[model samples]
Target: MKPRSRPTLARRLASGLATLVVLAGVAVANRPMVAVAGEALHTYQINRESYKKRYGHWARLPVPHDFRVNAIHAALLHTGKVLIIAGSGNNRDAFEEKSFRTVLFDPGTEEFTEVPTPTDVFCAGHTFLPNGNLLVAGGTKSYEVLEADVEHAAGVMKIKNESPDHGDRVFDKGTRLRSPAGLIYLTRTRVTVPAARKVTHGAHIMVHAGAAEVWVDAEQKGDGAVVQDPAQYTIDGLTGDDAKNLYGVADKITREKQEYGGDRTSYEFDPVAERYVRTGNMRDHRWYPTLIGLTNGEVLAVSGLDQFGRILPGRNERYLPGERRWVRAPELKRYFPTYPSLHMMADGQVFYSGSNAGYGSDTEGRTPGVWDVERNRFRAVPGLRDPRMTETSSSVLLAPAQDQKVMILGGGEIGESPVSTARTDIVDLDERQPRYRPGPDLPKPARYLSTVLLPDDTVFTTGGSSGYRGGAYRGEPRSDLFNSQIYRPAENAFATAADSTVGRNYHSEAILLPDGRVITLGGDPLYDETGKNAGTFEQRIEVFSPPYLFRGTRPTMAGGPTEISRDETASFATPDAARITSARLIRPSSVTHVTDTDQRSVAVDVVPAAGGVEITVPKRAGLVPSGWYMLFLIDDRGVPSVARWVRVR
Candidate 1:
């Protein structure tokens, strides 16, 4: 046998270099595969029993195709059913077809039924009356037209009748009016002007003209028909005395953007009958208003765009629930941006949390304050960081209504500016001079985040986007966040929870259910994942069971009084009385667009009785507003029992 000779030095070096190149190529090719494997491992770990028991779990609800809706507004009724309203669902075609919809969902039965919606309640305001009826008021009377889409210049025209003997004058649609420039404009709808009335003085008499306003569009399209200055227009068909008696006046007629017009219709949704009962109409048409139930059982409606597509100038009204009518609240005149977060305080004063849906003048009504509606006095509160980013913020009165503390969560820049903040501010209203103080920051900048107060006294926040309606942020195409966190007020810190599968942003809501789970629904994103196509509304509902629910068996409540009065004691039968540690009387949420003034948890004094527990309701009307509440008994493990419906009088 002969021994083999060694290779040349050049050959050896080439072979070694080839080996290194192949290894580098292999490492580069396996990078994506390694990432996938790591993601799979993390998923499996999170799904394990130990991880779920610690971080909680999320499950999606099965909704039938026939029962699906856009869910613009949602309220949990006293009958343990959820009322979802989608009047036209923000779809212009649906509004044109008058296809309004409302649906009732029973979580226990997992059943859904459609309720006939008579009007377009999209962008309406609602609050719960003392009788447990939900009063829904104001909605979209007309959709907005952008400047680019405006083919004809338009403006509101005031028609005056100066002749006292002419009686009522009627003009049908398409009635033409001619300006001094000879430009013609046609009325969009019929107009009726009342006859002028003669006023008598001690020695003289004067006639006051009667006027009616109607929307009028330019007869011809283009800048030629645009009128920049206020002008008096003559009625085209009128002649001689009729022409002098009736004339049209308009401030401007230009192809500018037109805002959404408001509707004056109102209704009371009867939970027992499962139907909407017609109520008296509001005096002023409103869109994006806030109808908040006062301590006296009346509802105060404030801030919205009126029928003429103009922001109401400090006009507010009150709804008398018993009389079923609305009257102007001239004395309570105060302006705010649309859908302002107004929380009723224990002393009947309302606290404006500085959180509002984007609308109105940016600087005028953006101040945080305590408004004394009775005296028409407002005192501003300072120390709010990133105050300008409060347009889409969420504000909640912290747990234990007696604390009188409010926390404002993440928000974005005014309008659709694509800027967001992670800052959270808390204010103790019980202070002599209430001012906001900074709290822990969120994990990431967020907007339209939904915050739900759980029965265990913890606030669970989840599902928001870092951009404008989940569009673009920091150069990312879409920015809907799935991360969930539980904020422990006691610790003043946030703990990670299991991530949700769905992406929720604008038009989303998180409601705490009677069974100790948070149900989340509705998301209207501006763009899809590719950031090129329009996004669709999220119809799938997700339910979150907190970590406590996965810990062990929950406490059970068997019997309880159906109704209780303020400052009174009530007893209820409970199987796990020994383990029961605390009691919470939580108001069910009537929420939309992160604006829910109806939700506040009242801590009740609990004492263990024979095989049950006794709880006392607070005496102050502002502390516990008259309405239906869910009473939950929490055990030592921080697990809440199934709630029992209890009405507070």
Candidate 2:
């Protein structure tokens, strides 16, 4: 080839500049076009019947502007309506203004109704009762005050009354207490101290002092009034005899970061009345507690931060459904981290799967174990992979509760650490010496993953972040995952599902509805897409329809008794009776923070009758707790029918 003469510097510069300008123009023109084309292709692929048949489909529900509140908790009622509770929704301003919210959504009609929320039930624990009522107990009493924002030293003070003649004494808020050094502190809330009691013990009269605790803040600002040792203080306003009898005691007071306080108020949501009914207060204030309904029709409340922002130190209580009251259960004392994933096993023991949402010491109360309530004993299970990363993880009672298998999924390091793991492990509680075994790893490291069990004996998991509160990870600005999968226990594998349109992380929940669909809501990310500004709580809701829904027409069940006792057989009319292979009674989900002890599936033995099918309820009350359940019949093809409301007595 003929060698061209080298261009002059000016000529080369002009040519290079011209080429640069042309390339820049092309780049700018293709950016928007490429995004549009890619989105179009994704939409086409996901909408295709073949794709939807293999995987599932996700769609966003239209929520009215006024009805849209931050969904901090969700439960599916027996009436097929959803109860969504926000209760300030982690908004400090809203909590201060008392702008709590609760709404009811009817999935059948897609209608919304606002309900009056009496208190801040945010971060509270809830479970379904035998009568189909939801027992909601303990919530946010006070928001956290970071060390940088704390203005004064504070501590809990116990007031004692030693005079048997005096009646109960009520001290209003801001009551002052003076220490020996003349330092003063004010009570943060009103408190009532009972009168002293005289008891006869072996022919002797013993007078016992009555006491009550209240939070107190130093009267003076800064740390000058901080006390490091146990001390007694005199009541500010009292007579000569009263002053001696009524005294305050405290261990220590310091200018430290104040964690979120728990509330003692409790309520039972009456599904039929569509209102909240006040119940007796819990024995202990609790935030991030877990309330699991026991086989005896009572609820066991465990693991929460107290009103003074201290973990309750294993003290637990129980709710009496008959009297609508909570009583201290001193015999069943067991400690656990806040929001522990506790499930009641078939043998009536609670299995703690080592998954906790946060707010406890990393070294304490994080062991996977089986707790015997009657005997006050715990047996730890070994061989959990990445055990230190159990915070913000999820655990589920594998489908067909009879199998007694539990699986713990993805989690991150304690506190707000950015580290996460894709680890998954399973343990069979039925084994004599059950130990955790390795399972398939997740596609990526994740936290706050929502796992739901379906009637088809498969678990559907979706929506999590690879970082804390959906923050930045690796080189990405945000780590909210859209991918989903279906875990088949029979096959011991996972199949890919459709991606979610919205992100779900901390404070989010996924509930299995009566019609065999899962509705997912709520995500409180630490940062927005840019990872630079505070993220807004996600108010949008999404629904996922599994592949079974798109397979073919589902079996139909009709005309069943409203109540059936254990060991009793009930007949239900169904046109597809011959094709039905099995039946399941699935308890509805009342979930928050990815911890749901109420959701479980009990297999029912079914036999084809003359014109319908008869299902024999299991005789074991521990396997199937007394409560309302959605009865679903699954055909041979693995498709389940629309659930029929049934109550097991």
On lDDT, the candidate that comes out on top is 2
Best by TM-score: 1
TM-score (all chains, Cα) for each model: 0.93, 0.93
- lDDT score, residue 255, model 1? 95
| Model 1, residue 610: C-alpha shift (Å) | 1.8
User: Taking the tens digit of each residue's C-alpha lDDT, what string does model 2 give over 25-112?
Assistant: 6657787555555565577678666788899899999999999999999999999999999998999999999999999999999999
Question: 471-581, model 1: which lDDT tens digit per residue?
Answer: 999999999999999988898888999999999998888999999888999999999999999999998999998898888899999988999999999989987999999
After TM-score superposition, the amount by which residue 421's alpha carbon in candidate 2 deviates from its true location, in angstroms, is: 1.3
Clashes of 1: 0
Off by over 4 Å in 2: 1-30, 197-207
